[model samples]
Target: MTDESLVRACQTGDREAFSALYDRYIKKIYTYVYYKTHHKETAEDLTAKTFIKALEHIDSCDPDQRFGAWLYRIARNTVIDHYRTARPALEIDDAWDIPDTSDIARDADARQRLAAVRAEVQALPSVQRDILMLRLWEGLSYQEIAQIVQKSEGHCKVIFSRAIRQLRAANALAAFLIILYATHSI
Candidate 1:
């Protein structure tokens, strides 16, 4: 069923409809949260909180609004609140069990570059960074980003265009996945 149909069913108290909605959005929401926090456990917790809050307030949701937009707004606010409430309350273990020493030097260099690029992206203004995250990471369309960020589609396109230009100018082409596409060394 369409999200709208599911939403209407949910409004009418259909458990199955709510379940479908949760299934549809959970991964995307988790990915969005993970990219922000860079911690698996926190992302999972926030994703759960987002859906719980969504369920709590679903009745007040406007059926005319895009479901993804509404859900993401909740997620964004939740993240903001989490940051406000506490600062790194927990340390998540990210140790890898497998010892993949196939290319230790190359892997370390790649990780350093990735960290630098992430730092650059984070330095961008919130909207530009969000546009890049929603577009590049989540593979969300400009229209979807427009709704999620509450901006005009044209404005979102412009912001995305500028973000790419900025990244390229700053030699952060690693983020643009130019590993093999670049003709000259970046």
Candidate 2:
């Protein structure tokens, strides 16, 4: 069923329709929340809360808006509220934080790279990172992202373009450091 139909059913208190909606969005919502918060447990909690809040207020949502964007907006707000309450600082861990060097080295390496990228992303002002994440990760169109972020679609495209440039620069620096390390090792 289309999201509109599912939402319409949900608005009338159809439990199965709500479950279907949750099934469709849980992973995307979780991923969006997890990357923003950088905490697994908190992300899980907020993912649940986002859906519950949606269920509670689904009637208030405009039917014309894409349900995915609406759910994402809720997830974003939930994460913001979490940050407001926790006010935790972001910390970068050393490369050796993963203890199992043999079995998990590949996974660890990927996670380390992702962590580095996430750190670079975190350094960006929230608006830019939010736009990048919505566009790149969530596969949201500029128009949809603009709706969620309350910006013009043209402005959203500009923000995403700048964010991509910033990410490219950070990646280039990382690549340069890797080359330096390899040369030093030799």
Candidate 3:
């Protein structure tokens, strides 16, 4: 069923519909939360909380809005609230327990680069990061992101543009550091 159909069913008190919604979004929501908190336990907890909060307030959700965007907005707000209350340290953990050391080593550099980018993105102001994640990571359309972030579409577009520029700048800085390290090594 389409998200909209599931939402309508949920509105009419279909428990199965809500479960379907949860199943559809839990991983993405967890990923979004994990990126922000950089801790497995907290991300897992917050992901559950996000769904709970969404269920509690499902009636308030607009039927016209895409349910995925709505769920993501809930997840984003839950993570922000968690950060406010917990003030958890954000550090990327590089340990992935894949059995093959060779495979792990092969991807280690790429994983480290992604972690650095994630850290840089997380360091952005919440508004910018939220919009960027919703647009780029979640693959929401401008209008959908605007709806989720409670901004005008034009404003969202501007914010997304600036956020990308900031990410590019951060990447350039990382490149410069790598070059400096290479020169020092030789």
Candidate 4:
């Protein structure tokens, strides 16, 4: 079912509809949260809380608003709140989403490259990092990111561009591979 139809159904207490929405977004939401928390259990906990909160406030959702965008907004707020109450989050691990290789040298090289990229990306200003993550990792559109970040679509594009440029300027190879890994389009 379309997200609009599913959302309407969910708002009207259709548990099945809500489940569909949950299933559609679970992985993307988990990835975004996991990248932020860097702890599997904490990411899982936050992901559940985000969904529960969404169910509680489904009525307030605009049927026309992109459901993914709304869902991400909730997830973002949940992460922010957790950080406020919790200790400083550790930097995201380099191999957080990397698949292991049988070739030890290749695996070591990949991890080292990923670590270099991660350090630079993590060093970016928060807004830039968020823009990069949503655009690249989450595969969200500029419009969806703008909605979630409360920025204009044009501004979102500019931020993403600047982020890419910053990474490239730091180290071309790491930046290239990081961008490649982060994006499906490129």
Candidate 2 residues 1-186, lDDT tens each? Answer: 999999888888899998998999999898887766555666788899999999999998877788888888898788777655543453222112222232322343345656556556756668788888778777878888988888899999888888888877777676787877976763
lDDT of 1 by residue, 1-186 (tens): 988889899999999999999999999898887666555677788899999999999998888889999999898778767755653563321111112332212234434545657555654666787789898878899999999989999999999898888877787556466757667664
Ranking by lDDT, best first?
4, 1, 2, 3
Q: Which stretches of candidate 2 lie over 4 Å from their true place?
A: 88-111, 168-186
- Tell me the lDDT of model 1 at 141: 92
For model 3, how does the per-residue alpha-carbon lDDT over 1-186 read when each residue is reduced to its tens digit? 998888888999999999998999888888877755555776788898999999998888876778888887888777666654543463222222112232323233435555546556655667887787667777878988887788899999999889888888777776788877976763
Best by lDDT: 4
How much is the lDDT of residue 86 in candidate 1?
56
Global CA lDDT of candidate 3, please? 0.73
Q: What is the lDDT of residue 33 in candidate 3?
A: 76
- Position 136, candidate 2: lDDT: 76
- lDDT scores for all predictions? 0.75, 0.74, 0.73, 0.77
Error of 4 at 173 (Å): 5.8
